[model samples]
Target: MARVDAAWYVTAGWALDLFQGRQTRDHDDIEIAVPAHGFPDVRRALSEFELYAIEDGLAHPLTPETLAISHQTWVREPATGLWRLDVLREPWDGNTWIFRRDSRIRLPRTRVIAYTEDGIPYAHPEIALLYKAKAVREKDEDDFAAVLPLLGPSRRNWLAKALTLVHPDHRWLEALRAGSTDTAAR
Candidate 1:
């Protein structure tokens, strides 16, 4: 089996694993995200696994830094076209750290969760979603839909705070509050 990163489980992936439970069905491809400087380390660490890089850059760019160092992973899929393995990156400088996430966060360690097509370790489900949300694209929205219900109250709060910074004008926030209203029934 391939090695995997087990530490980075975000609420989304955790929710997917909880709600979907060990996917019996085959997935197109798995996705993961890591800080940019860490990408080379991850790539070097996973050298034994089948590695293919995507030039088109399908995943959402996490930041301007992510754009500067755009990357995507491609694993061969016999029927579903090329499956994407994306890694989202954000710049880190302890002096000017302006990220909006809560302080209790931890960067996950690399571990073996599942193997890739060529037997490289893929990232865990929760880690995948955490990274996926960083991109915040249409597909990521679909991902949120599939996994949002799985998030617990605390994680949801974290997600809300994070997105509030990322998308200050986000309509979903209003919709969410409306959904919570008892008066919506009237």
Candidate 2:
């Protein structure tokens, strides 16, 4: 966690929800991602809330000592102990975003994030779908189905290329290449 400030964009299923202008599915927790070096700024900005580091599926106090190793952090609502935020510290270069699992996959930050009409930033649905391709849970597949035809050809091509780099034999490649892209939906 560094002191520098950076943008934190909504990610995963919730990001798809934001893009669709509604909550499309029930999510275990909402997630956001910031450049890894900018996490301390997030901690300082959200200091009023309690934060914890997840270790082996357990929540531990998020302190300076744990910051280096904690790629993900949970913001817990004090009174209810209910977690409300999941923060992912992602690797980023000047104007470029790199996939943490495979640095070979990179994109301009502009293409990685898109904003809603109300100005909330979110990960592109195709990028979210790419992440989900790693482990296609029932919910992930549902999100894919919901967002597939909404993608433009460029978005579909980008995601298909990314999947090839990370998970060459990923099952979703077939569907992404199925020519379902609809420019009107984008």
Candidate number achieving the greatest lDDT relative to the actual structure: 2
Model 2 lowest lDDT segment of ten: 177-186
Can you write out model 1's per-residue Cα lDDT over 17-104, one digit (the tens) per residue? 4345554333444455444455555555555444454446454323445345454543334455454353433333332212324333
Give the winner by TM-score.
2
Look at candidate 1 and give me any clashing residue pairs.
2-120, 2-121, 3-121, 4-111, 4-112, 7-108, 13-126
Q: Model 2: runs farther than 4 Å from truth?
A: 1-5, 181-186
Please, what's the RMSD in Å of model 1? 8.1
Q: Per-residue error at 40 for model 1, in Å?
A: 2.7
Over 13-86, each residue of candidate 2 has an lDDT whose tens digit, in order, gives 99999978898878898899988877878988878779988777777798776766778899987888787889
Q: Each model's RMSD to truth, in Å? A: 8.1, 4.4
Cα error, candidate 1, residue 68 (Å): 5.5
What is the model-wide C-alpha lDDT for candidate 2?
Answer: 0.83
* Candidate 1 backbone overlaps, count: 7
